[model samples]
Target: MNLSFFDQFASPSLMGIPLIIIAMMFPALLLIHQDNRWITNRLSTIQSWLLHMITKQLMIPLNKKGHKWSLILMSLMMLLLTINLLGLLPYTFTPTTQLSMNMALALPLWMATLLTGLRNQPSISLGHLLPEGTPTPLIPALILIETTSLLIRPLALGVRLTANLTAGHLLIQLISTATIALLPIMPTVSILTSLILLLLTMLEIAVAMIQAYVFVLLLSLYLQENI
Candidate 1:
């Protein structure tokens, strides 16, 4: 069921920009509150333990740059997670399904990857961006294809997230709406659909976390590759 697109301005007062604004503040507040020697010492101890456990996969030392990257990614994940959970309420909406919101999250990472690659390895970054050992005859074709595919990554990521959230929300709405419509004739089917939606809602919560993790992990991998 394809519902009309929800406008950014045409939202409930409490569920509109205010909700997203507050959601975005969660990470900032956390970081701000932890800005101290005690929190720093505790975080250092935890990071050391984490590094010891993942010694084998350690591609680079967690320097200032790495720490900042991790902080930014974690903040994004937290913000998205909060917004998603908020949408599960009685009359709230998920801003993540909005193209503008998703792209706002995706484009910066894409730009960061491009800038990092160029900044770190200015001399050979372009050459390395294309695969090695391409036949001279097919070089142009390969470059064209690879460039297009590279550009599509962020687009695909944005669309994938938006589509999933929209689909799940629509499913819940349809089930509930149908249940109300057929309450007298087919209460059992409506009840079953509602149960399925409830289960789906639970699964979607997990999915929201998974999506955030995957996005951050991929961004890390992209950064690692450049360095």
Candidate 2:
């Protein structure tokens, strides 16, 4: 009732201290490892298995040089996954919903892949701008289009991630708020809305997990192209 719908997206702060920093650190703190032994707990075992599966899948198309990125890619995946899922809780900010943060994440990584290609295979990299056997008249236009697309990759990445997460969060909030308001007036309809809200919550959970994977998967694909 207090904060406007959009205001909820604003970074939370207290006493002039920005708590978004703590929100960013929360996931890392939760991920800290405190146990090391031959016989690990079931939770640790499952965590290891999940990471192994993800790393193997991401590496399938990568060569030896690209394999060096598996660790960083996997860590990024885990961090995004943790923060996204955590943000689904009662009161927490989803940092990934912010365009600035997503862009910061996308730009440098995309640039790295682009630079890697230019450094290792300049001919092929620049050659991607123009395809072979193009009609003479269309050559200029095709090259311009391809170059624009290549430059737009990072913007697409950041916007895609931020938009999807923001839309899902907004939908959930709208539905939940309606359910609460309707409860006092119409109990039966409220119950129905609540059920829908439950299902949507489950779907948002899947979206959170999938979007994180997609973010990493796309980066790996970009890496694949470059390497």
The top-ranked prediction according to lDDT is: 2
Q: Write the per-residue lDDT of candidate 1 for residues 1-227, one digit (tens) a residue.
A: 24343332233356344565554454445432334565467666774565444332333444445555765665566577667666666666677777778888898887887788788786565775478888899998898998787788788778877887777777667677777877788888878877877898898788776766566566666666565
RMSD per prediction, one decimal? Answer: 5.0, 1.5
Clashes of 1: 0
lDDT of 2 by residue, 7-61 (tens): 7689888999988878888898776374757788787778888989999999999
Q: What is each predicted model's overall lDDT from 0 to 1?
A: 0.67, 0.91
Model 1 compared with the native: what TM-score?
0.75
TM-score of each: 0.75, 0.96
Model 1 lDDT, residue 48, Cα: 58
Model 1 stretches with alpha carbons more than 4 Å out? 1-23, 26-65
Output the worst ten-in-a-row residue range by lDDT, candidate 1.
1-10
